[model samples]
Target: MAELSPTAGESNYSQDIQVDEKLVPKKGLSLCSTRYGIALIIHVCNFIAAAQSTVINITMVAMVNTTDHQFQFNGSTEQLPGGPNNAPDSLPAEAPTYDWSPQIQGIIFASAAYGMTLTMALSGYLAGRVGTKRVVGVSLFASSLLIIFSPLAAELGLISLIATRMVQGLVQGSIFGGQNALWERWGPPHERSRLCTIALSGMLLGTFTITLVGGLISQTLGWPFAFYIFGGIGCVYCPFWFILIYDDPVSHPWINVTEKEYIISSLAQQIHNGLLSALPFIIAWVIGILGGYLADFLLTKNVRLVTVRKIATFLGNFPSSALLVALPYLPPSYITTMTFLTLSCGLSPLCQSGIYINALDLAPRYSSFLMGTTRGLANIAALLAPTVSGFLLNQDSEFGWRNVFLLLFAINLSGLIFYLICGDAVVQDWAKGRKLTRL
Candidate 1:
């Protein structure tokens, strides 16, 4: 294999590998240097993360049910579960009572979001300091460990569960951040959009699979088993990732000189420098916040509006309360939830790719910085979503959920305005005006 050249104007210590022109055409390079393997590994990692998220959702319902059926009405010595502090009195007064209320559930769900918010903001800095591969591997391992322990925390008390979930969220945020940086480093320019879409789509597939599998496990083996199974799956991926992935294109033995050149040249033309590069970050932030909120809103309300009435009618056909009892037993609810979740997963990535592509189009060199900044900002919206949703649900008004959706829709509309104003495809002339400056 030929030795790789250092990036122009950057020091040797920077270890930046520039792609040459010969890599563009498949015929010019050997199979070993191609990007297919790298893309596949990244996608696999994404799938695992996506599946993990869905499994948590499924497990939450099962755990709450288990707590309700086994502890509360049994008159056990356990204290009633609280949100952040004291337990609420609204818990159902019956046998097999649960300690925590819906409000508490919302808090647990939001814990991850809070952790994710902080980590995502710092991800770019971390990746720059350490390297994408290390960050990715560490985050994946940490997330898997936290997920495995989450059920044990649940058994301890509500506070434990929240704490564990918050840790998982922090790891998850790093995963997202690291993965984004990895793509920028490894993916080819021509195929970035397609690869991004594929990675994201796999995430949707994983989300759907998790719901299906978690629901089945809950119905048959029990709810705690769902966490065990998903956590195990996450652990399995770690070894595979370590063996298969590399941080940069030239580092891979299989990638050929021709393909590497093609990738480098394709990316070189797209980078922009200076404050002008920040424009895409702002645009993506506005878009992602709206997109994230809309996804949660639709999952919470719109699906029910579209399908719940029919489901209720079908259940009503059965004996009294029989449908209510049977609903959890059936897989349709999980399937419906997964379907909606998948749509959100699918849409958000495509939207994000479009934004990123525009960034590259306008400023190729600054793409990484712009992407990092925008994603960090977008994550702030993610942090607010679950907490805001919890607050609305706590209101106990008839239109609580409705109000949440309304707010989400308004946010999405605001994003649309930004998209129209700032999301132009044409590259701006910011970098051309400045003298050549190397980082």
Candidate 2:
């Protein structure tokens, strides 16, 4: 086997590296390739899932009535619920706004997470038993319908809105596990990193797009439009998913015979040749996409797989932790603070190539179940992080933010250290269906 020199990282020799032909396309890379296309389409599904989930976070700012703030009108300040001076006529006409308390808002923010935590493990198991195409596609369709009606639900009452969101969460909770199930069948072991990360990156892209635009849509067209537009996109994408995706290459109608053989042969070799296989809470798209390519490139150059996972994990965790430590000390400019925060967030996606993909390496058969278990547990943190931060801020605003950053730094640092020490890429015996016999 070819091996890259230890000093190769210090040089540009990677440019001259010859990737194994089994993983590389002899005809040259093209998006039209079947597996790549499937990955890309799954990326869109992730995008929609993320957009629907987080758009509410931004639009809620516009949805709530700012009763405490006074608006300037006719050179005299008047309370909100009245028109502001010289407001654009083209802006959305006044819509009903909620007077939800901070406590209620907190519940709304965490409502989906509650549902997600409850359903995630079950969804994973279900995806494996059923099939990824229907599980994921149906979830997306159901969530989209709920989002479209979210505005109506909110107007009806707080309970109605929460119920709608909770149900939406229940459906979307299936998506991640379903995605892993798809990769189990569709991804060749050699190409696992790039294929999985490419799809996962869509979540980041969707988050960024919704964050950047959700506010504007809420401000101009009204908050309801944000829900409508994002939800509608998910609905429209369903038909394509049902039409194009199959459980595996062997079953796909349009996959060429050569590509089918290549995928199947690659996976079979990995099972016999070696054991086992194979993010962040918020991420950036570019980092993930690039990190996946880098990982696959390193693997192609004969770098040990475990070593590559460690490298990616360190890059993902350490710098972000350090950045969090320094964030509280940055100059108080929002621009500067936001720049640093974005940098920290952008660093997180590197794990896509590391611990994030490790589940598939350990056990292809149970990838979905493992993903669900891990993600569901992590989301407990997601469910509580905001509430915890809010509680801290309520006690003391300045130190609360500082403590939050410090807490994140400590958590990330500890996780990085543990993973660096104990992380493995080897498949476990159980993953290969070895039964433990009683003595």
Candidate 3:
């Protein structure tokens, strides 16, 4: 090391210090560190967030499938033990589901998407200043309350129910707003894929768990219980989130120098938009183990991270969409069509690893905001896609479905081209900020 001295240099006054002398040797990576503890909690948080969103898929079935269960509360119908929060084993045989039309059902299905689109942009901006913990926690808690009240809204009338769902959508839409920042604070550069994947997969896991558990609860206790139970879980999780987690390594009380330094040093280097975050679970639900393994395998092979991600995006978008475009024109063969559909829809590992985790690659500091923008955009798609599909299918013919798939194909192709051309992996200039240093 060269020391600065008045006589050594006329203008310079700096000393050269060996970096290694000031650094501690890296410890072995562990699965059960404080960072991971945070990840586990976040995973559950995501699970709650996702379950509330997806449980709707299951609960709606009991409401609509029986057609007879009009939910009249005619005194003859028994409300569950917990009141509106629980549904009976079965609706009375002659009950009708409020004489709801398919169009109304479609509108209800898309309400959350609209609400989500409205808030995602705002949420991202909030996360940057207020911190991820507060934004996500409050958003989730609020969304849970809305879910609990969903059945109550249903009881009032169709318009009331739509209003309730829109609020729920807006609430839940903000839940993902801070996820990218949260990960940057917690994730070490090298371990981001594993840590982020595991944490984010909670939503996917929630979706899966709901399919299994929601059915049993809706079948045995009643459909309202699904919303109640899911909402309650989120409310319960809020305390733990506030108590155990902080914005960054420096603020976390339980972390040690070894881990803190490691995390800080690593992050010092480094969404779904909302739908993107939800994609891994989609792939996992559809493709299962093989897709995940394929993603990890490529990473292990020393492939450039950007190339790996690009490949994943290409795989996810092109073939599947192309298949959808061709399906309507194909010969009448169920096995062939089914095969095409399964591969196209089910296998999406590229999305799981590529677009889903692209936040870290772009700008780690602004990731939350960036993620929010993407999520907002994605919700716009969510809102529009269904409407478009419905419009195309209005004719109730193969031709209508064909048009729907064709539109999707065009959209997918455009996204693929844009991503290929504009997507990147290098850490961007915006992320080189002091604000990100802490979290």
Q: Which candidate number would show the highest TM-score if scored against the true structure?
A: 2
lDDT of 3 by residue, 1-439 (tens): 0000112211111111122224323565457588888878888887788778877656665655322222221213422242232423365332223445333554665566556644554566566567888988888889888888887888788899888888887777678656656775776534554566667667767766776787678667677888899988888888888888798989988787788886776544231133433333334344523544666799899988788778888887898889878876666665565566556755554475677557646654334335434543454453355445544443432355567777888988998999999988776665543221122
Clashing pairs in 3: 68-95, 68-96, 69-95, 69-96, 70-96, 87-222, 272-276, 272-277, 273-375, 274-375
Q: Which is the better candidate, 2 or 3, if ranked by lDDT?
A: 2
Summed backbone clashes in each candidate are 22, 3, 10
lDDT of 2 by residue, 1-439 (tens): 0101112211212221122243555666435679999989998998889888878776765666533221211123434334552233334776456766444665676567646644554566566678888899899999999999999999899999999988987898777656666766677644555677678777767776787788689778888999999999999999999999898898899997777876766555322101110012123445666787899899999999999999999998888778767856655454455455556767877887888767766754345335434643454454356456545544553355567778888888888899999999886666543322334
lDDT of all predictions: 0.52, 0.67, 0.62
Please give the distance, in angstroms, between residue 438's alpha carbon in candidate 1 and its true position after superposition: 79
lDDT of 3: 0.62
- Model 2, residue pairs in steric clash: 276-427, 277-361, 278-361
Best by lDDT: 2
After the best TM-score superposition of candidate 1, give how far the Cα of residue 131 lies from its true spot, in angstroms: 1.7
Backbone-clash count (model 2): 3
lDDT of 1 by residue, 1-439 (tens): 0000111212211222224333456563433544666666776787677666556555554455333322333345344354432222333222122345444654665567656645664664566557667887888888887777777787777788888888888888777765666665665543554455555455655665675676577666666676777778789889888777777776877666666766666555443221222222333344444544553465477563223222322222222223222322334343443333323322332242234334444543333234334543454554456457546644532344445555765665565556545555443565222332235
Looking at candidate 3, the ten consecutive residues that score lowest on lDDT are: 1-10
